[model samples]
Target: MIYFVYQILPHNCRSVRSILCSSLFLQKKGKKGAKAVEEEPVQVDAKDRIDFDSAKQKLQAVVDRFAKYANDAKLGKTSPKVFDNLMVQTDHGDQPYTSLAQTSIKGRNFIMTVYDPANIQRIINSVLGSGLNLNPVVDPSNKLTLKMPLPPITTELKNESVKELKNVYEKLRNGASLGKNHTLSSIRADARHKLTKNKKLDNLETEVWNEYEKLHKIYVSKLSEMIKAAETAIMK
Candidate 1:
């Protein structure tokens, strides 16, 4: 009965004519029907093929994310046996638990049929955060290796320091001959050359001279006029 239905002619709505002509009835009439009732030329549904392709694409993306999201922490779950099994699904590091395992289907089929875009994104973020922030010592064997952040410089001090740095280098090179490299020892030695001279505003980089700028200015203002007047009296 079933074979007879498939052999019906396709000329009408049900192709009943062909079906009957190709079945047992046809054999009685001396025209042998085709051996097989199922035809290979059945038209496939466009939507189904599209749906499958789309599903496959989505599943692949999820599996790829799952692969990338592999890490060691996920494998070290409380259940050692489960860890042993799931660990094979991923590479190294703390691989996160995937929903695919919860599905009744096999792991590979879940990897193929599963579609979870948001979960994939979450897994990617998880992978990003899973990496350990390494803090290696500059010299591990030294037993005292440390890296400290430098203190921030004030704007005014930074500008002044920059200006003075050039003069400090030049003094170091040229003043080397006079033993005036501007170090504490060099400056103290130079100071001994004068008995009671005012601090000079010389090396721009040296803050010690800057410390005396105000006092030097005040003295020069108050004494410049009197010294000139006394000089005139002596000359006359």
Candidate 2:
């Protein structure tokens, strides 16, 4: 989900000013020989759940890294490549984006996706300007936050989309029964191609995606309710 439009800035010389400055000292010694120095990572607690305080600290560390001017000379304007160096991940895998900082030039949109799907949600939740980080607007994954508020779709529209997807799915079933080689990708691709060719397809694509999202949410909500009902029955 897209969040936070930021004004592009210039003059980023702050990279030189490294953090934890208090640890560094002026050790001017005789015959100063320089060798590589490996810094230690800031440690966190072994708690299972993430504490908000700890989350805030981690967020600050992220901000500090990207807090440089949007147009730093070292990091060319509109280049999200620099964040690749930073190893950001979630329990599942590396995050889709570390920090998605976007800037538009004139009219063309220059978007920077951090692709750190692992930590993507935490960062986006933090960036959304919300005081509290609720689970997620749409939890694509533990790391990825599909943060946009779900578009309000009429019941008719939802029904129609379900019908359409089912119809397409039926075609896939029919094709398979005929011994015509058909895979999920093949079916989806065929359906996608047809949808893409439609005159009002852009609108249709959004509605269709929304319908899928709604169905998924419904499944999860209903599944949980069913589980609770079953548990109660068992207890009785």
TM-score of each: 0.16, 0.17
The window of 10 residues in a row where model 1 has the poorest summed lDDT is 71-80
RMSD for all candidates, in order, please.
39.1, 34.8
The TM-score that candidate 1 achieves is 0.16
Writing each residue's lDDT as its tens digit, candidate 1 over 1-236 gives: 43443454556655443333445655665533444455779554322222333333433443333222222112211111221223212335544344322212222111111233334333334323443221222223422222212223345433443343334333432333333113222333333232224454334324443333343344334333433333333223
* lDDT by candidate, in order shown: 0.32, 0.37
Of the candidates shown, which would achieve the greatest TM-score relative to the real structure?
2
What TM-score does candidate 2 reach? 0.17
Candidate 2 runs further than 4 Å off: 1-146, 176-236
